[model samples]
Target: MSTRGNPWAVYRRLLSYARPHLGVYLLGVLGMMLYAATEAGLAGLVKFFARGTFLKHDPTVLWLIPVAVVGLFLLRGLGDFTSNYFPGWVGRRVIKQLRQEVFSHYLRLPTSFLDGQQSGHLLSKLTYNTEMVSAAATNASVSLIRDSLSVIVLLVYLFYLNWRLAFFCIAAAPPIGWLMQVANRSFRRYSTRIQNSMGDITRVAKEAIDAHRLIKIFNAEEHQSERFERVNEANRASNMKLVFASALSNPVVQLITSFALAGVLYVSERQVFAHRLPIDVFFGFFAAAMMVPPHLRRLVNISGPLQQGIAAGESVFEILDQAPENRGGGLPIERARGEIEFRNVCFDYAGGKGPVLQDLSFRVQAGETVAIVGRSGSGKTTLASLLPRFYDVSGGAVLLDGHDVREYRLEDLRAQVSLVSQEVVLFNDTIRNNIAFNAAGKTDAEILEAARAANVIEFVAQQPLGLASPLADRGQNLSGGQRQRISIARALLKDSPVLILDEATAALDNESERRVQQELALLMRGRTTLVIAHRLSTVENADRIIVLDRGRIVETGTHQQLLAADGLYAALHGMQFNA
Candidate 1:
């Protein structure tokens, strides 16, 4: 939904987050009322000062006026303090609540949804957009409520003093409102552009930072800098449009106010000379009239933040509105028998792309090893991704232990499979913690065993802290093989019935590959293992091999059988050794 079409709709939703702090919010409103009343009180005090001190010149009135002035100021100070402090308290609470909800929603968003989004844009929404929402929901609201009340109270005072002059002051109201409406439209439009521009800026900056090594190697520093400047300049330009709208609005509104004020002063002067208006009464009326314009101006100026916030709220709510990843069916299982089947599977990505895998069917028996070999676009990884339910097939079923994989609860189903791919992921934690990542209840002995089996103990022993030693970001301190072994250790600790090794040692050197291969063989024991490898020699011992070409399985047999048949598998095998 477009927030611009129904701004109050977005604004009201934003305000709901502040409901938990309603008591504090009410206190702030009350303070605003007190502050507003004091403005009228100040005008009243002017009349009292003029009448008693100038006209009567009484000694008692002189003494009381000074005390009244001090008392009035003290109340104003208290009111200002209450209004400022209490709303700030509520705003912070709203921010905390909103941030948490957005963060939680991010975790549940479908993988497909995440695939289509940039990390920088998501991060911007978490930090920057949430702040804008708080400002719109609470900070802008404070100004709108406080300034409106101040204008109302001061106008009522003017009417009480003299009905004619008060009516004249409101003559500017209609045109001012129209002008503000126009400015508000401009603000919201540009605000949305500014938000998108900020996301672009974040996207560029993050890309440059993460790929600094790539940038340096390619001598592309100038290219990245230019990309950043483009986004940065766009953000500034969008902001300037908002600034131009805000800047033009106040002065034009003030000019309209000035004309009305001129009219009031012209009429009041004539009435005073005619003896219809008293000097003290005129002072009070004029004082109240003068106060209305500033408050009115602020009421118009508040549209900037108010509309900007609405735009921000729309961005945040869009994420919250997305459907989460599908929850699997009610079947429960502690473990699977490791039998798997893909019955007539057909799958494709979004945007009407042709199928990545089509009419593909396969099976692996319990404790048997199968390998899938293919060219770059032959759907090898895609086949493995489907087994984990990363993407549901367009037309087929993936069965485990004679039931559709979807019949088991997602957590229960995922618990039965482990994967170690070429792109090994490690956190900035100790070696022991990395191995025991998802094995929360495992004892220390189990963790140690997994680490030792995966060859992690060899290099870890060089560190002073051994298994407890902290790694750098993404385990950058470790060699390629070290990172791969940690991943293998994690998979080992899991010890699930099904294992997928997606080129697990593809990035390692000859020595690293040999050492890792030994551990992988140990990992493969008594499990339904599916290996996707580019290197044909790695899968030579598999019970069976499936060769894919253009989303179809063109050949399937044991290594020797495929070699005897001399088809796609034999050709691919020849090409690899030839290289």
Candidate 2:
């Protein structure tokens, strides 16, 4: 999270990704070695030609010059091909692997972790942030190795030809290093801002599109556009700042390099004219000087990706390093009966606030249908969420079949309790796929049966492709009631022993509510059901009605019994629907 630059730290982290592609990486290094040798050979040849330094100087040697030069280029070309192509292939493979793993991790993450995060922000991390690894793997890592080696090989030859001049050229490296430090500091700061702004832009764009109908109805198009533009402009400004910083550093280094080369040339010419050095040595110095600029330029240019790649590396590692949620240990409960118990249960929504459920104790016998009636913010939903261990109760225990829910593996605990909340969620896939979600072995017939049970089969059959008809993103093509029913169908397919129907009929119209309420009643039969209903009529026929007031169970009895008591339940029933 620190905003300081550390390119070497990034490179080391990247080396972990390279383990899978080590063979191709080794090939790239081999290619760079061959290319560097070829470059060194060309420098040696130039020195040989300049002063007839070849031991056996004749017509044959003169004719051989072009042949040797052509062969060097041919080998260098082959090396270049391997170096470029292999790393690109490796980079793509890494992307595919990392994306799959990140997605899988997201699936396993606890629901509490997802509550406050935006879907669009997570999508950007998975898609855009991870894709930066490609540039890091190919252009950044490969270029670093190839160019750094080339510079070293060429410098060795320059030293062999003329040590004094080579030493002078080497002296300029410290100033270049200082400039890179300044550039890297700026790049790191801007790079972090760019990444954060990308998330903001993605969040705003997703909101604008997701609520397009609302925006239009309210005529807020200009407002949404302005919000999006502000975030977009911020992202653009951050990226451009990094660009200008890099541009400033590279050119300044090049200018200094140009002046240094001129000084080296003047000194070498005087030494050669006075016979203090051989003419071939002087030409060799010039050849080596030419190699320094391009090689040094590449070395300097590495900063751009080096900074960005390191930033990406830190982000990726942060996720990969996270410890998974803890699920306590016990023997796996093979058969989960519908019995549930809350013992001295107390929970706070944000960990330290006053308990939403204080000294809450409750028990639901197997095959019982319990309707919980409460006003909004009375902690009805929070109490129900504890059964699935969404947020672990800060005080006591939520037990299933005499065992703590946390004692069971998260998968097993959730598999036993299916919930259909008022806020319905559906993926952008075929209706059949949405119904069969995470139910890997389910068949089309079974999926259809569940849909029919939820009273959604007839509507799906009307679609052009039947069950195969694609639902638009987030099931936006479907009506609110339709989306809610589809969710019920999904939960029905899950076939959990305990069903939690949380205000499933709250937002439906009279017609849809009538049809859906009938289906829900049938779905709850013979199953241990905990229903949270805002409409008093929906739960009037329940076997038991528990009225909660300010996190305490104010009354518990049959609906008629609660009405007779004329307590909180009766008060709520009268307030909502005078009876």
Candidate 3:
């Protein structure tokens, strides 16, 4: 599956990314031309020096030769510098653009696109694949164009100088051709394996690092090491195969050049003995002939990096070519009144055997608190996710303020709604930053107020740094309850009109839950809220209680009314209350 696409198709795809950097890339090529002229000029200098002191070497020409040499060297160095620098600069720029585009695409991609994709694989595509494209396209292309032109110009000069001798040089090309073809085939074969192995290596590293605690808790350090060793060994073997194949190129080219040098020496010597060629001309031809084969060899060598660049470029282009999720949309709404209605909504989650939410209908009026209770796999989380349009409903519609969520600008819709789930993700930063994740522009006073509302400020204040106290990655420095509270505080700061709490208090102890729930009530005041609760007691005071069975709404009423009705909600209440 690694090298499935047509090579030509991949090339065409990669060329599209180069369009924007074409000017700088072309300038880089021009620099290479200047550099090529320097090498060619040095050959011309050899012929000049071969001329005798009397008539062939005039004082003026001799004086100008050193100056020309110096000028050529300076120009060549400048050209080489720009050629290397600009392409590298362009490559890094392209990488930045590619990373941003790929990440943004991943974010907007439909859940179905991302369901089975591994984080490490995606990371490899972003980092490894992107770098490869830059190296192959920018660096490799510049080298090919420059050296290739040098070869062409040098060959034309050689043929002009002596046609018979040039034929001998051209004769050496067959063996060189065979060698390059062999190397090319070998490299292409091993390179694909190497690339695939790289992806596997990255995946293992990401998984092992992410689950470090789990590995430690299970006393499976040796097991993790074994798994990593297997992946690393596979990667190492693939790399060695590529290196072995790559190692053949230089030796093969060098061998071909050796034979061609012998031919040039033999022909040039005969010409010198027969008095048909001057000593200077013979030496000039000899030197130029030596230069051509190596240049040709290098031109052949460029293909390896070119091939790799193309492969990596194709992967990056694939991501960049992906269409954004909501390209067409209406104007943003200035404000929303928190009226939400799910009108016959239906949705199928990624890789689901069937629809998770089917023909579901419900509504939450302004300033109403609704609690949705359901068994596991009953679409409780799926239903809540649709409100924010994280995954669009497949059928029917989800409306906010009487407009389809899809019709509203995504940012506008999201701004009106805030969610705090059981799984809290915190950045590796200060506690203040975690609380202010959603509202980064909030003042310290605003942050403190939000933390107090979520019942985290009192605890935060005890820390010497208060809001500035640093939190480790994923907030490992804080307890699970503290992390959840920080997330809740973030949601509170948003102060949106619509709030969705999915087991927000699930991880907290009774004391913490009580305090946070008290803050949650104040946060929920004069807002529309949908709470997904496993503990029936927590949502007993909700204005309405809805019991979901499978994908459908089985019953709807106030908690007291449903409890008295002895329905699904009553049964769940009894089960949890007893447990």
Q: RMSD, model 1, all Cα superposed?
A: 1.6
Q: Clash number for every model?
A: 0, 0, 0
lDDT of 1 by residue, 319-408 (tens): 888888787999999999999998999989875478899999998898899999989878998889888788788898999998998898
Model 2 stretches astray by more than 4 angstroms: 1-10, 52-63, 351-353
Question: What TM-score number comes out for model 2?
Answer: 0.94
Runs of candidate 3 exceeding 4 Å displacement = 1-23, 53-75, 172-192, 438-443
What's the lDDT for candidate 3?
0.80
lDDT of 3 at 21: 86
Summarize candidate 2's per-residue lDDT along 237-343 as a digit string, tens digits: 99999888877777898987877787787778788778888777777668867887787777677777766766766666566555556665654766589898889
Residue 393 alpha-carbon offset, candidate 2, angstroms: 0.7
TM-scores of all candidate predictions against the true structure: 0.97, 0.94, 0.90
The alpha-carbon lDDT assigned to residue 90 of candidate 3 equals: 76
Ranking by TM-score: 1, 2, 3
Best by TM-score: 1
Overall lDDT per candidate, in order of appearance: 0.89, 0.81, 0.80
Give per-residue lDDT, candidate 3, residue 460: 83
Clash pairs (backbone) in predicted model 3: none
Ordered from best to worst lDDT, the candidate numbers read 1, 2, 3
Most accurate candidate by lDDT = 1
RMSD of each: 1.6, 2.6, 3.2
